[model samples]
Target: MPRAKDLDTVAPDDFLNSTLKSPLPPRPIKKPQNKKIKHLHQSSNGKSHSAQFRQNVYGILGKTKHPFSSFLVKPKVFNFRERDTDEEIILVLRRHWITNLTWILITLSMIIAPILLTTVPLLESFPPAYQFISIIFWYLITFIYSFEQLLSWYFNVYIITDERVIDIDFNNLLSKNFSEAKISMIQDVTSTIIGVSQTFFNFGNIQIQTAAEVPEITFEKVPNPEIIIKVLGQLRQEEELENIEGRVK
Candidate 1:
């Protein structure tokens, strides 16, 4: 081999020129992607304009899902009366079936009696006027039954709300009386189911003694008066506890 120093003689200028002359590999060109812009419209104008454009957008874009943005505004507090702890109130109503029973029986009687009387040969021998009067009487009886039932359903209705007890008495369609008492006033509750008829029928009366002007409130011919009395008692106890706590507070 020739002398090492002579064989490796290289110029920096020539090396640089060779490197600069070499072609670079082609680069991939990336295309720009179109994106949708969301804008909120001014509430007064009901239209929104994009920052990049002057055209008004008809509808809201990306509006907040919650309409009540209360965080952006001051919160408000409302004042209301709190319930007394020593009072428990409940709603009571006559059983639907019991209330409707009189109507059902009357209707059955009206239908059966007329048919039985008119179909009998001897009864049919009565004058046409008598038959007409009998028919009228039957209709009258049915009307009376209907009227009574409607009156009872309307007036005899009792509602026990948390705050008070309400008694409604409808003597006729035209006559009505309403009474109410606070649960705190309730002193005594009595339930009575008298006779085999009432026991079998599951109907009875509930009597309430109160501290109010009205000494006693009686709910007549109500269903499951015992259960109602028990519930009322429990409510009364709860109310008493609440009252004691309230006094302490």
Candidate 2:
């Protein structure tokens, strides 16, 4: 008999015996998907409700979610900082969408009225130079009106932070009113939702009475007034507790 070959030197068999089995194939590893990345992908379609929801919660400043925007819509961060180290924005509030309806409609009318005026025979009676000047004047007026309305809305903001609540009022481009109340100074929080639109839209005003110099801070036409009241109450309680603990320490 030939000497037995070493086990390692045996020829590999393509077909195994009926009683034998090949080793199981290695298991595949799975990758964890990031929620933010998945949200961005979903937003590509622009119809994802969940993506919009996430944007509202996470802030509108793209990946950083900083809550500030160049556009006048849902600004998450006002870029206003009360404290550098510990200040964290809990919510940024703006007037309800319905509140802008008047200005938006007026803007539309301003845009459309000029075009409509061109159809009038009165415009045809004017000289070419006069007509051109008139058009320019109308457009300039429209621009000024639109700019003023947008600035009013854009600058009017209410911000709630861990330490304080702020109300910024823009009377005009040159005039601004800023008020703040510390969380510890909050004495009473209440909200009012009146009118069919306010009720239907689920938005109203939040009135915060505080022990601060301002005494009263009102966040007008803000969305979800009840929620704001609840959050304010909770924050006030937390602040009081912190003050007590600090005194003890």
TM-scores across all candidates?
0.53, 0.67
Model 2, C-alpha of 222: deviation from truth (Å): 0.3
Best-fitting candidate, measured by lDDT? 2
Clashes of 1: 9
Write the residue-wise lDDT of candidate 1 on 48-161 in tens digits.
Answer: 211111111101111223312211111122111233564332344654355476678877887778777767889767899999997898889888887777656644666564
User: lDDT per residue, candidate 2, 144-244, as tens digits?
Assistant: 98898877777788877767888888898677888998878888888898999989988887788999999999988887676666666666655555464
lDDT of 2: 0.70
The lDDT values for all models are: 0.58, 0.70
Best of the candidates, TM-score = 2
* Deviation (Å) of 67 in candidate 2: 4.9
**CA deviation > 4 Å runs, candidate 2:** 1-77, 81-84, 247-249
Candidate 1 residue 154 C-alpha distance from true site, Å: 4.8
